[model samples]
Target chain A: MSASRHRLGRLIGNAVLLAAVATTLAPLLWMLVTSLRPKQDVFDGALPSALTFDNFSAVLHSVDIGRQLLNSVIFAGGVTLGQLAIGIPAAYAFSQSRGRWSRWAFAVLLLTMSVPFVVVYLPNYILLSEVGLLDSHAGMILPQVASAYGIFLLRQHFQAFPRAIVEAARIDGASEWMVLWRVVVPASRSAISALAIFVFISTWNEYVWPQLVAGAPGMQTLSVGVAAFASEEAGTQWGSIMAAATIACLPTVAAFLALRRQIFNVLLEGAVKG
Target chain B: MAPALLLFGAFVLWPIARTGWLSLHDWNLVSPDREFVGLDNYSELLGDPDFHRLLGRTLMYVAIGLVGGFLLPVGLAMLTLRHAGRATGVYQTLLFVPTVITTAVGALVWQFMYLPSGGPVNELLDTVGISPVNWLKDPSTALPAVGVVGAWQNLGFSYMIALAGLSAVSPTLLEAAELDGASGWQLLRHVVLPLLMPTLLFLATTAVLHALPNVFVAIEILTSGGPAGSSSNLLYDVYSNGLRFFRVGEASAEAVVLMALIGGAAVWQMRLIERGVTYER
Candidate 1:
């Protein structure tokens, strides 16, 4: 009886998991199907009867999707690079410093993470406008460069680094920068990869900041571009919108799939320790 | 250290301080000088019924999302944990795809799905002998519909976190439970959940925060905070007041309220998290 009950429990568990998987993946599958379907057949929903690339073509041609895609790529790339450039050194300093001030600074960084984007959006807009950087890539990327989460993650990884290695490198007369690059970075490949994936995905999918900062058509990122298509007053053109969305989602999805292990590791660590 | 501190001070801290200062004045986009308004914004916000409604809506959104988006995802993660095999990675990837999609895109896709006529959701309902329901058009259903989308988008992230927490559970403990003839439900309740409390707390807090900001997106896309501003949340109120109506002072006051609420919640969560986390030496 106990054995049978165990088998029953296992069966139920598998069934529930499969159901969860289906529920989670169904909308994405629908998105792909809708994107590939001909425009008129989107509402018809009989597997399109004849799948076509027309929606993707229309989305690309009718919209300034190419320019928008480029803008998004540049913005995302710039933010990722800027954050790494600034965050790495800061994280290193925080890790190496042995003072109450550093500890207090770290706490302040943690506190700042709770400040929502809305709180900063208005002031940043005004500041950027005053500096003639509004609606520019610099404006888009600069404010987001100093990420508390990135600094925190990198600091955690740096703390886990072998102090002996850094000591030996210093004994060899290596500079701090050289030790950071040659010793710490080389050892923390997983953490760096994880942070990169996280940052890329976030910057790619970010909406509100991009919407507010990059209002000009030429400066708009992919998220805002797709949002424009969706929010238009014309009749809902499901196929084209889905196609645009699919295109917008491609880069991040590709990145996530490519760095799946690293992403999972970072998420796992964050979940356990966050 | 100097370089890092200088950059942070110039960029992050200064901007935050500037926002606080800006909130105290009646400022505009093009204005050279700002009028001094000492707590006038706060008083005006306290008197506004719309702002109160939006705060209530935001609270409701957080509540619904915490249960559906946050807890449901944890449950799904636990379910996924039972199947630790080669295909688990595939499942994880597929499930997390929605999270990478932009909120605008997810809202649009779901809007199409929830269309009263010719949408798959309604068609499925018809097959089960139920009449179609207008999901987004109705005020009562709009917030919940958007909440569902939010849940769908966040399900993967929450699941991954919970799964990671579950992985840290010692197999020896499970084996011991089995030897003691503890049933599946008993093992889950008595052993697994207590051990997973820290992860759960973290997930819950972050989920609430995520949900609060997201109400604005949902309002913007689906309802624009309307059918008479029924779906308006604190963020949307801030946006509407500041951007739409050009009422910077009122918007600043609304924002102050939002900041206070979120800050309070964060503090409460930090305390809970500090108490809950158990370090294994």
Candidate 2:
């Protein structure tokens, strides 16, 4: 009787979690389904009676989504590479340095994570315009390259590296650059990659910053482009709007799925100060 | 190090100082000169009834976020510890999927989901004999509706953190509690919940700090802060005042106030992390 009761408990537990999962995924699934339905048949039901790729084609044809996608790639990729190039060295310096002042400096840097972009974007926007970088890819990518969260997370990972390995590398006459590139970096590949993926995903998803700086028609990232498309056309075009959203979402979603384990492992580290 | 500091200074630190300076003067975007306004902008902002409403609504958004993003995740995380079996990883991965989606796209997807006629949410409501609600258009529901979307996107991240906290609780202690004749609820309430407080507090703090900014994308995409500024918050107001309408001085003052608010939370957050580390040890 106890065994059967325990089984019933497990059965009920599974049911609850499954329901939660369904509720969580239902909206995304509906987005995909609605995007595929015939324009007139969007409200017909949850699942489309027939699949159609015309919405995707229509949105692509109507808007410069292809250019926007490329722009997103360049913008996100540039920001990611720039952050990693700068961040790895800075994180390396922080992890290697020893003293109270260094610790305080690191703390100060981490505190900047809480400084909301809305507060700073106005000045940054003006500064960029003053320098004539506004509405350009460099403008969008440049201001965001130095991320406190990235440096902090990378420092955490770098701190975990074995000190003995570093000592041996130094004794073998390895320069500081070699010590970082040849010794510590190769070992910290997973952390670096995880940070890269995060930076890329975030840069890709960024809305307000890009919207403010990259306002030009040819330079609009996928996020600003899709949002602009939706607000203008939402009154009459559910299918095409969903299609644009799907396009905007695909790259980040794919990156997250492919690197989920690294992401899940890094969550505890990020949450400590995130 | 030099390069990184230069970049950080140019972007983050310098802008903060510039904003503080800008807050003291009146300047439009196109103006060549800024007029010194002293505390006038602050006084004007403080005296405005609309600013008070925006502040209140911003707090409401934070409360909504605490419940939906922080509190609800705690419950869900506890539930996951039971009977999830081998599919635990799969469940977690699927749940976190929403967090990676672009905020703008996520808002657009939700705009469609909350569609008044024949949308999925209303269709679900219709099955229960309830009439379809105009979720976004109606002023009364727009704020909460948008708040719910922010919470939904954030729920996965918070849940993962809570689950990690739950897993860190020693099973031996749980067994000892059971041996001492403590009921399941007693063990949970007395032991598990206390241990989870640091994680929960962290989530709550982030939820509060992030509530206004995170909802910016949704508000811009879905309602543009709405049908009469009904859904507008302080952050949205700041954006409009600064960028859209070019009220530079007033907006900078608002930005200063916002930074102070978030800065206080960040200090609290740092203290919480320190305490949490010592507690864990």
User: Which candidate's TM-score is highest?
Assistant: 2
lDDT of 1: 0.77
lDDT tens string, model 1, B183-206?
A: 867886788678777767777887
TM-score (0 to 1) of chain B, per candidate? 0.84, 0.91
Across residues B92-177, which tens digit of lDDT does each residue of candidate 2 receive?
88888888898888888898889899878899899999999998989899999999888878778878877776666665564455
lDDT by residue for model 1 (A1-274), tens: 7578767766787777778788777777888898898776787754767788888898877789889989888888998888888888888999999899899998778777787776667767777877899789998988888678788888888998989999999999999999999999988887887888788778888888888888788998988988887767244788888888888878788877887888877766554565
lDDT of 2 by residue, A122-206 (tens): 8999999999998888999998996788888888878889999999999999998999999999999988887787778888889
Q: After superposition, how far is residue B45 of candidate 1 from its true place, in Å?
A: 2.1
Best by DockQ: 2
